[model samples]
Target: MLDAMLPVILLLILLYVGYTLVYKTDEPKKERKIHEDTQEVKEKHVEKPKKHVAKRKNPVETTAPKKQIQAEHPLLVHVLKGHTSAITACAFSPNGRFIATASTDRTVRLTLRESLKSKNPTFKTINLPYDYATACSFSSDGKTLGVVTADGCKVSLYSKFKTKPECITTFPVEHNVLSLLLNDIGEEWMTTLTIGKDDNTEIKCWNTSGHLLQTVNVNQIQNYHGVQSLDNRFIAVAAYTPEVKIFEIQRAKDGSFSKLNKAMGLQGHTSGVTDIAFDGSDFKPVNHIVTSSKDGSIRVWDINVRYKLQEDPKCIKQFQAPSGYYSTVDITPDGKWIAMTQGSALYFLKVATMQICCEIQNAQDDDITRIQFDATGIEIFVQGTTSRIIKVYHLPIE
Candidate 1:
């Protein structure tokens, strides 16, 4: 009986061991988990293409950065060549139909804007009474022309609309005229003149008839370029010492105007301030002044804050140029763009962001003496000083 009981107990123990091996193990669950993980990876791969398609639908998001990149190659529309010597100054007619260029060759040429390349274009060529015709400007109606010369400190007035200018009158200045600007209406003008080979310069205000209205001594600052505001309410002079002197145009109740007094001084440039421009004001308030310097910097000043801080007028915007020595600067009529010259290159900057819209490298062989934008801001005229080449460029529209 003991042997039989031992055999039965052994058989029961074997059956228990077999049941534990078949049902108590976790291998199937582990295999199912691995298969689920592999399915999740496959689902991820299926969703990736949908995300890529979403990105492809919005190409503008990728292409928007291209707008900020300036044009590497500038489109040159025309090159004008008629001057015998270096072109000293240039001005665009208010109507945008003509351009007046003065040169050291003792000649002032009025070239038709539409036909800059025509050999027999509609133009008026006049010989200056002196060898150096330093600067020239046109009246608002495009009826009168004003020219300043280095010899005898002479300021000559001429009438337009003819094949040749008819001398209206000549005014004598006390010093060599360096810069001249006429008001928008042409009722008044402003000038900066040097004093007898000295570094001393004076700022003068004159009427359209060549009568001196007021004068201020700017000898301390070496002011070389002066411009009147669009409303003729202020005069700004760019100093070689890297400063801008602004004077308010005051009017008395007695119907007489008073002499200019220093209203504000803008100082930021590390080198000489080469050129200055004001807001063109198309029924909008003129509140800013733009300046370029020889130190390769440009600044925009707020006139409202200038009155409060005359010693150091506040600059709202500042930009470092790609190169040094900006010779000239001009703002568009709508205050949208700034056309500036750095060496022989011409640059157009968007006014809002100060980002370069486009640049024309090697625009000429020599330095650019002047740059002016048309009333519509669709065209720009650039003149190389010693190169004696005038270039016309069509501004890119957004």
Candidate 2:
């Protein structure tokens, strides 16, 4: 009986040990599942804030569309943009029906003023094969176009420039031509040359046939500018000297150009003169001439004096630029306003008061090369050294 009881006790003890081992193993798996569930909840909580942060940034991103609209100038009327390279010179026809432009791209373009606002503005291109044009002018009748070339210093005349273009003649000049202007009848043209090998500034007159009619030396080092009166009687030149020299262009008995004689000198500025302009295109006796100088002053002279009687030209009004020198100046066709350029800025002054009426700062991207008014004086055209586009502005004179 004792042996049978010992076997039973041993079996019971083995069964209890097996049950305890199974229960302990099942408890740890439950604890691991609870820990994994808590970690998943925490991860979901962290992702919600990231989505909220992205939603909060939507308002700031909506403001970027405002920059798409560019502001345009109030006075700007038209922007002519067909030149492929920098424009060197530009001029309006005498009648204001056409505009002529010369560019470094070795092409001269003629455009109608009426078609400037069209979608495809028509441009008649005149190719310069040998060199580029440095300056250009129109005949009094607006039928002939005169262009000055850079290489060889040549003057080219074009006939029927309005419809069919023809290069009638191109002649070599003696000196480096600074500016060229055709007379009222278009038979003769005048050019101002820089200091020549003879150490003189030369003002030369030539007929369309390329014959040198007359040459006058200004006894100066550099010839900066030259312009003729509308009546074709007087030529005013600015040079390295402060005094502006006025010359009378003599004509032959048939009204053809013959020679030029020194008339008088305008003396006032302290430094070299940079540019000069006549008052208007129609002058009964040419009463006034405007000049700009390195001395930073624009002087209006009463040129109607009797210089033959040895009466000196008088400076009636003097306007000093706020800073820097004026590179170019032009009086309106009505002689009511004076337009000038200093650096890249443009200014308009009332002729009566000599006060600045309007100022357009940064009118060009670079130095302003030329500023001109239309025949009607209602529009102003501006060209720049590096900017390829020509700007046309409607003057708010009223």
Candidate 3:
């Protein structure tokens, strides 16, 4: 009886053990499957918000390019292209009807100002015989165009420049011309020439017939940069020195250039001056002059004082450049704005407030060589050392 009881109890215990093993193993698997499904649902919910957020950003990304276009529209007006090489110099006609550009391509192009926007703009190309043109200027009457060549150091005058351009005269220069200017009467011109191998400079006055009237030796001021006043009465020279000298173009009763008298010296800049510009208004004599220097300062000088009385010219205001040396500067014809270049950037400052009104970075492909305003002050012409294009920008400020 005891053995039979033992066998039954053992069978019951075996059955209970089999039930526990099978049920407990399947319960955890079901729990794990449910947890995995919950996690997958949570992941999908998280991705849905991410997709919604991305869709919400689509409009903002689409509008970004429009903002860039609006910012660029007001600054750039026209890009005059034709030269194959770097542009050396550019000048606007006195009447603002034409623009003359000299380039390393050994050609001078006179383009109609109004035709710049048209495809295949109307232009007159004057092929130079020598190397390249270094400087250019227009007579006050806007009837003649003067260009200086580098190889033979010659000055060529062009008459009927607007239509059928003709080289009227080509005269050999004594030295390399750094700057050239034609008098208001168009009968005479002046040039700043580099003398010898010493980097010294001199100013030479000449008649349109190829005769040198007088030579003013400015050897003391090495590396001379000069600009003529609108009235053609004075020349402001910057000589890689802190002081800028003003020379008066003394004329005889017959209206011929007699001599250049040193009128006064502007003493303010701590370093060498780089460029100079006059107000260029219709005033009889230019009273205000702007100078830029390596010291990173642009100075406005009041030259209306009595300099013969030993009075120094007063610096009415001075503004600092953003960085690097100021390569060139120009004041608008209306005297409302001053434009300057530092490296590849162009800055426009309001004359009345002395504040920067606009700044365009990387304005040129290379270092900017020159910056000038049109006769009406509505457009500005900019050129670089290596860029073949002449960029004409509209003044955005009033």
lDDT of each: 0.72, 0.80, 0.80
TM-score per candidate, in order?
0.71, 0.81, 0.78
Q: Return the lDDT, model 1, position 344.
A: 83
**C-alpha lDDT of candidate 1 relative to the true structure:** 0.72
Task: Write candidate 3's Cα lDDT for 252-338 as tens digits.
Answer: 776666777889989889998888888765444577889999999999988888877878889998898666668799888667789
Candidate 1 vs 2: which has more TM-score: 2
Q: Which stretches in model 2 have alpha-carbon errors above 4 Å?
A: 1-70, 186-200, 283-285
What C-alpha lDDT, on a 0 to 100 scale, does residue 372 get in candidate 1?
A: 74
RMSD of 1: 18.3
Q: For every model in order, what is the number of clashing pairs?
A: 0, 0, 0
Q: Give the TM-score of candidate 2.
A: 0.81
Task: Assess candidate 1 and give its TM-score to the true structure.
Answer: 0.71
**Model 3 CA deviation exceeding 4 Å by range:** 1-73, 186-198, 282-285
Least accurate 10 contiguous residues by lDDT in model 2: 189-198
